[model samples]
Target: MNAERVERIRAALEDAFAPCAVQVADESHRHVGHAGARDGRGHFAVEIVSAAFAGMAPLARHRAVYAALGTLMQTDIHALAIRALTPEEAHAAASRG
Candidate 1:
């Protein structure tokens, strides 16, 4: 749940996708004594809206996000929950809210 690590994640994703919106949340605290947390890595949830995901399938989007994070996936991050969407999907979601 380190702020620095979270910021790094956000920066990397932004650089890769040029996302219109990105939200990164550390969920490590909830995992507490979980096995992965024991190793000092973190769990994170990310919601990103971008043109890069426009025609991608769900799995492809997740893979893209993973690729964006690069080595961070093996170092700073233990688990990731991703909600990737195209700009139009994000706009639709916003309207619903």
Candidate 2:
């Protein structure tokens, strides 16, 4: 299940952003008794840093990633947490902390 989600996310971003860093974490265990996980679907947190997002707004970048995932949202995925950013933004975030 986690493997499938990882593959789907990887394929989506690889095809769309050609990301420099892509990390997909299955956080289903965190919501063991949560509403969405009752049916056994996967809840994921994705952290992606890519050059493709350089000029895009945050909403646009999120939409682009969601679009890339396609039917997986309706079928295999229940919730997705995304931290999508360009390399520069990622660097800024890192420096901030």
| Candidate with best lDDT | 1
Tens-place lDDT digits, model 2, residues 1-97? 6897778878887888899999988888898999889887889899999998888888998899889888887887889999998899889999999
Which of the numbered candidates is closest to the native, going by highest TM-score? 1
Candidate 2 lDDT (Cα, 0 to 1): 0.87
Q: Per-residue lDDT for 1-97 in model 1, tens only?
A: 4798999999999999999999999999999999889999999999999999988999999999999999999999999999999999999999999
Report the number of clashing residue pairs per model. Answer: 0, 0
Off by over 4 Å in 1: none
Every candidate's lDDT? 0.95, 0.87
- For model 1, the run of ten residues with the poorest summed lDDT: 1-10
Compared with the true structure, the alpha-carbon lDDT of candidate 1 equals 0.95
Candidate 2 error regions (>4 Å) = none
Report how far residue 43 has shifted in candidate 1, in Å.
0.6
